[model samples]
Target: MANHAKAAEYNNTSISSLKGADRVRKRPAVIFGSDGLEGCEHSVFEILSNSIDEAREGYGDRIAVTRHRDGSITVADRGRGIPLDFNPNEKRYNWELVFCELYAGGKYRNNSGENYEFSLGLNGLGSCATQYSSEYMDVTVYRDDYRFDLHFEKGENSGGLKKEKCHYPHTGSIIKWRPDLEVFTDIDIPLEYYQTTLRKQAVVNAGLTFELHDEYSGETFEYCYQNGIVDYIKEIGGEKSFTEVQFYATQTKGRDREDKPEYKVKLEIAFCFNNEINLLEYYHNSSFLEYGGAPDKAVKAALVYEIDKCLRNRGKYTKDEAKVTFADVQDSLILVTNSFSTETSYENQTKKSITNKFIQEAMTEFLKEQLEIYFIENKAESEKILEQVLVNKRSRETAEKTRINIKKKLAGNVDITSRVKKFVDCRTKDLNRRELYIVEGDSALGACKLGRDAEFQAIIPVRGKILNCLKADYDSIFKNDIIVDLLKVLGCGVEIKSKHNKDLNTFDLANLRWNKIIICTDADVDGFQIRTLILTMLYTLVPTLIQEGKVYIAESPLYEIAVKDKSYFAYSDKEKVDILAKLRGKYTIQRSKGLGENEPEMMWQTTMNPETRRLIKVMPADIEETQAVFELLLGENLSGRKSFIEENGYRYLDMVDVS
Candidate 1:
């Protein structure tokens, strides 16, 4: 709860001998990668990784995350308690040193063969770095019949571990801490984010069991999957038209000489294809390869080669196109590629991958040889997959051609005015100092155009409802007249006429005419629909525009509380009610139904003034979810749209306008 400044004063340090702490603080990017939300997530990963490492060592199985009522999180694991033995000469218990120190875990020396093969946790700096970035932390260790506790504020230990009386038959460790408010500007961690991640981990770890409870919100859940990646494939693939199929294979060869035991390479690929377009792949190292490295390339190459060979032999594909590119066969595919190696030197302290290139090559060769035999023997399934790939190839070509033609027209500027004429052009040419007000209907558009900022403000009055971009691809999208005009006005040079087109300039290189695109719609269902349409287009075609902080939606008051001569604008019903209570005898409240009904001065005072206007910037929390929603709403599937509306209609905000 305390501001980050005080915490940093105690935690921040520049000592050179503290190698792990220095590395993390100096090159935080190397450890957590960024100072943004993703990097904050990395801190959670660091903690979870340590717990998982215990499981890999065959010492821990159950991990629980509890969100305290006060907003702090506790992560506890039942693993072999951290070693407490002391080197009499060093005179320090290893458990205390490891918790307070950096780069201090046993997996570094391969004490646990499971993790030595593949890991995804910090060497020693993870916990220490987390401590540095947190305001307060407490770690408890249960080892050798003794319970010990260490407390720290920032990074410095406030005091030594206090010997604790045994409370129960317990082992492993428990860490309770709150991230520093200064380092993490976001004080509230969304429960859904944690839920999504922990559920995913449970799915990936297979036999691992995880329990989570949020005391703040009274939410609790448990996750475990005995089938592991196979269950993951089914869950991610959802109700898609694909059955779970796992390809199992392995290979071995002597490491040094004939006397050496054969070093083995094991590979497991679980995959399924749906009726969608892009590919989804989850890679890991022995249940930890977060992203596949050489191992991935080997397996994919073999899989493609085998499928291509089968297709060609069955007279389904030509020998010329028999070399299948990974992308071609990945249409609507959900895949998991996991590999285990006895020897590795991955750059990451977490050891997420096996870097040895030789093992990758070996895996590829083994797959190519064995997969060829399997597919040849199971002729029916192989032919079906080959046919699907061909269909995907054709669809891809058509989409590309459409994209090219649209871009050509946009760049060529061949009178792309099917809708541009409807926009009320602004006279000013200066872009940075200017802004555009995109309003719904001619009524609100007329008010905005006359509100008198012609020198900087342009008004675009959109007709009826705009296109929902989710269901359409790039080609079908450009066909919408309203969408094309909006892009042109915004200085987003449209793809058109070939790059060499030297004639009448179609591309508007004129210094961008507006710096802000503000959506001002009526306070009604139709208005919300129009705003969503515009937002969808920006999300798909010009995501960078939003990311760069250029798009915003204007907040128009729903209720205009007019008591006698004085007027107060209320953006919500609650505000209107509160305002009415204060003016109990002096006023009669009037709720304005729409922007058009409000006089020019009232509109400027409540919704247009730079000082008073309340605007909401659209930020996509999950790109995948946005994409899926858009596809369902706009795609040709009427049933999907109906289902979505029925399921989520309750979430829609009620809008009111005083007319």
Candidate 2:
């Protein structure tokens, strides 16, 4: 133990002692795992896991996560606090020891059969790993009438807890850590990402209050869901709902199906199928599968099969009926499945719980029992819902028919290729090197094409104001020439025809090829509208493109300052002010009303040139919040969009173009 302790000690180490960030560079994976957003998410996961573990141990209820002003993070929890003691002979406090030492925590007591049972930080290296990866870590502990504090710099203990006696004391733990700049090359934490996952956690752990503050943007939010996943389901499926029914089931391991080795499996699932187009499925831990595992698969399969069987018995489903896939089941359904296990194993680094195979069998039976009772008790309502399913079946068939016609149009098997002539496509087939600039008008398109590297950049000019496909259906979309051309260029294959020869007119989803899709419309109101239209279509129809980071918005300079023989570009009003101040000599300031205003050379220099162009990358901070906003803005209802615009339009409106 002494040898191990001595080896773990980095007593003389300092931030300056390391060579060129090698401290974090040497063990990059130990900190973020990899150098990307995933690693950044892993850091967040570590903090969240620690907080959740504290909550699970009944030591904390309130956890506060703050995005510090200095690209750091502080997650403080009201828990029993990290232990601080010494092997009187070792002459060190346990809390301080834990801070610098790896594999040192009560979470690993499972080997000893200690009371510290389940936890999110089972590896016992979570905090230590964080400390080692961070440039600095401040840990303060208040527990059992004593207060303890410790600080570390670049994986080395910089200071120790003060031994002074205190007048008052509280019980909790606070960890403030700054991921070493040397470790993580990029530092862009989106508040929405944290909000989404944390809010979900609050819902999964009923009564667990989670608070988040983004000092960068002066934004803060608190989440506390008393009803847990039940409320979560209701939130997602707002107006899309059916008969409200909650099921509670418990099955002792041996008494139930003799499938696997376990003591007991207990869980609760709440669901209500609605008329909405999307399915809302929430997974969890603690009576919920945090990262849905085998149990989720088993439950879903059983429910769909049972629904098919029950409907068939009632003469509602035909034997030759197309088997409704999971995607079909989710068309208008909101489901929350909670599977609890005495022993839980995570599938990946994010610690998404996936343990116990028999859980699926157990959950299947539970869902069957509850759904059966529900169907029997509400036979009329169930039958009505089934009728709705039949309607979906018809709509799907119609949509499928439309799909075939579009395929022929896209495949170039007929004269439909003429419809795509408006697009100025690049000759390059290399997806990684190719980019598309959806310019507003012919003038901007001409400038972009002239300024672009013809080898990879493609320019497509929209004729006047483009059609807004927000509320448009497949038929409406298929009729629009602009949408058809864009779709054909994107390589999202045309819709295939049904078995029966019919003009279904559907959009094919396989033809998309451009890796970098930039919406380079002007910075004015019209440009904003065009951008919105394109985003709405892309987000609604092909979301994976955005998810995969293939979409971006080009930042065109609003102000071009030509002083003497030199020219400078300013993207924002503040930048213009600063640049004008820097160049005090006589100068001519020109405001670019739109992309069309810029000459080909100026356009390339300021917006189209890869070497100098500025681009805004969209990232979600609070997924749930984003979803709510998207629904409010782009949903079928006009009231939500109107109310949202009324409340927040001022901030969003481009004042420069608002005239």
Candidate 3:
């Protein structure tokens, strides 16, 4: 009886509910999805969505947002101002319903077209929830030749509602609020967030202008896309696109189920296939979908189906060839999808995605029909797209095979004694003290090996000019025995940037055997070419080695000055000039011979000795410019190469091997 009495203490009265503003102020993540900076940013988006909805409904065309220096945000829109007076039907003031209540707004009767038909803020929770989560909020509305103002602090009404008659040029609302520090752990939204969000909104909402003012930076930015997604697609595709931009738009009314009500849907798709650039963006009701749900599925399904059907009809695939996938098409495709629906089934209140079954079905069917017509009408474009997508597919498959083979070939402990040919390793196992010298040939390698510190220095010889990695494919480049042996000697695996070859990315800096990888080549045209080829191989396959400051160039003397009983080495013309100016006795100057002809003492003093030799660290600060130059000189850029050679060929006239 005593145990039963103790348990019976938990009764109906024990069940408590959060009341008024406490409902949202206490558990903010319940509505905003988090209590961190993301939630604070979503709160700002919630307010901005209301303004976007008003502008999208044709009530306005311009919206202004401001990021105040004091951590407040303001969103002002030129639209039909929010009603703040009394409501006869509900027998409550509109101010109370909009500012205090949670689920109260004018967007519910969307199908009737009385309010917002296709709205971004349809849940009726944005305005009130944002107000409740604010430390202080000031709302100003201009309508009916009257200006109404309301102020709230800490989720409570302050000074009630203030109404005054004034002559205003436009009817709209301006809301400035500071998110509460107590409610959220972080509220410092960055300017980049606003720029990206407003740009995406402008892309979806055609002809709507969004102006952002950052008081912290004292700068203003404007985003307006007159042609909407079409313009965005062109901007993303740039001049590298092979196909002209294609735009398709349609609207339909449908229902997910017989029991569900029918709603209207509008879809706009803009796409182009580019060789150098690719992007995929999806938006619904002006909200960018970071995690695309329905439209993503629809696009993938329709494109694969239509493209595969076209390829089969044209007999482009062999008997045993596999069908293309979305990845294959996506490799060169730049597309943007903007869609809206009156009755949306959002995945959550944050509104990152929608799960409406009818929307997906409608979009998929519409895209399939349009694509079939497009392929039939534009034969040239269809051919180009088909060829490019096939190339991508075949390349992806080959890369996959190459990745698997390379992983298997390069995996395991690098036993240099038996696996790597002619790779002389240092006696020490300490990576910090070890060095690897990549010399020109076997003769140069013999000289370097004889002169180098055997306790810490190792030597590997490149037979001749290895494969030009910048101009060759991965399979062809890796097939070279010299390159394979060099990589095996280095012990650190390669890094491949392709998504298909991601699994083959076995590079780990800790696995590198040497502290310094010194490229030691003769100072001649052929040696320069050999050095460039070796550097290109490292740049393409093991870029991380250069980025981590592990690669270096061993400077070989260009001139050897023999005087009395001493010889001074000069690596450049300036060094030779300085040395000649400092000489006090009769001396004979002679151009240095190749590394193969150098004596062991000369090699040690000039190239192998750490205390006397000069090494240039290969920095990766201008890596992009280096890559562009490499591509122009060796990769597939014939016009660029021609232009560069024509403009700057004179600089290297002496270095050219005319003989």
Candidate 4:
């Protein structure tokens, strides 16, 4: 077996062009950033988003989604039906043109005819993209007393638009389509996902009722939040607020610049210092942002500044006292921020983050003013809040010192890698070729050190399981010696390591010490638990490493079968059986209890040799699913974990060991 790089430069590459729907199918990841289950989910959201945008633009308020049993989805909204009148510009019905054209929609401009003050779809690739990837799409629109129907097969018009009388007597839009199996990996719309998304939309867009009927599951769910973000905060963060500091604020500022289009910005924020962490979700035009942008940063800054200012005014601390940090502010802050921008700039094609520069200044001013008013009106509660802030400030100060000390102690230096007793590092300074193997115990580390290509591979040993980061905070990660050592060795410092003293989310990935991070633990039960801990830590703490395909697990052999003079490694019991049957000879089988039990040469042959070794790549196909599993198993709750073990523990009875 030979190992090669997929990213190597190939000379004389031919330039090509992919146009129309064929272009979308050729490079799906260019539009969706993925072709996995997440892409399928996004397809559903892209269609639903158009309907949601119509409601946002002062249309009908009801939006419904149905998950059919035959791998089909139907999204219906009682919103203003898509423009059905003939378009003189395109020389076709507006409805047909909108569905067929790639970059055709009402979201681009703000004119009186088809003005969209707030919109989720700006690329004009929402329903059209869905239609392009679907086997067939059927669209029905009703406006006044007329009903218009249009159909498409893989984004092309099946025939032409048909007009008829409206018997339903309602003005709305219905889009029904089944994903083309040839184009997608899977088309099944997950029920739990739809339920959560619909509920979240209802929370963001108040007065809008969202419903989901999963025919496959034979269940119906609906969401209607009249109080909107404020109510959503209380529901998730609980009614009991820290010092009873619970309130909502609206930041509405109109822009009337002649150069720019007249824009109405709606910034709705609900805040509660409940001393509990919940779904502190951020949104812009109802699109959920996993890594929040300017608005989220602004809100956090405002809370820290305003609270610190209020405390200083009361003469609670000396001028020399340390200012509060984001960790201090966010520790107890349960918030829901919904920013509606008439025109928005995003960092990527997925629209995961807003890059608007005005959001930071606009939001910070609004929040600061609101907090100042809250403190002045409720002086007693303000004192209680100040007390908690003092406690947090003390903890943060102590943790900061400890974090710096640990960074120096583990790495023997702060920025550059220095020789450490525990880590047997490689010689090469090239980051790309460098590999870091985190082994379970000293024995496995010794084995790795002996067998490894010393020019590239480095080994660090852990005594036992490191903290499961799913349940650990920055303080826990900073204070623990083992966790600190691991972070220092990796050089991708956990949350507490920031040059600018920013929050965990701002931890820079460019500082990563190694190009490849491989878990080389023992082949046993305890080793599996250790690997799980390391995986959870990396997945939650430094997700960029996993997303960039730097994380892997070395698969050590489970059994060594000696037949005659040669030995063959078997990864599973099935493989062992096959090897024995094919050899047709009496062989002695030794079950590998641990990597430590194997010889250095044996370890190299079975696991370390890159050419033939089986390295299982840990790619997080769906991060949301991965997070849910980790939380359920590694969270503070014992009941859910216990129930899971009791019901599914048998699956692990015949499991293979890991390296």
RMSD of each: 13.2, 15.1, 3.8, 13.7
Better of 1 and 4 by lDDT: 4
- Which tens-of-lDDT digit does each residue in 221-312 have in candidate 4? 98998988877877776656765425555646544344655455778787777654534778998988777888778888888898889878
| Range of the 10 consecutive residues with the lowest summed lDDT in candidate 2 | 496-505
**Can you tell me which runs of candidate 3 are displaced by over 4 Å?**
1-16, 110-114, 497-505, 557-594, 597-599, 632-659
After superposition, the stretches of candidate 4 with alpha carbons farther than 4 Å from their true spots are: 1-16, 110-114, 243-262, 400-659
Clashes of each: 24, 29, 0, 1
- Worst 10-residue lDDT window for candidate 3 reads 1-10
- What Cα-based lDDT does every candidate model obtain? 0.68, 0.69, 0.91, 0.78
Query: lDDT tens digits, residues 1-659, model 3?
Result: 34543455777889999999998999999999998999999999988998998888788999999999999999999999999999998899999998898988988883556588788887888889999999999999999999999999989999988999999889999999999999999999999999999999989999999999999999999999999999988888888999998899999999999999999999999899998888989999888888889999999999999999999999999899999999999999998999999888888888888899999999999999999999999999999999999999999999988887787667777478688778888899988999999999999988998888999999999997899988788888677889988988888899887756777788888888899999999998989889889889999999989888999999999999999999999998899999999999799999989998999999999998989999999877899998987888889999999999999999989777677
TM-score of each: 0.60, 0.60, 0.90, 0.60
By TM-score, the best candidate is 3
Worst 10 residues of 1 by lDDT: 496-505
Q: Residue 326 in candidate 2 has what lDDT?
A: 58
Candidate 2 C-alpha RMSD relative to the actual structure? 15.1
User: How close to the true structure is residue 512 of candidate 2, measured as C-alpha lDDT?
Assistant: 64
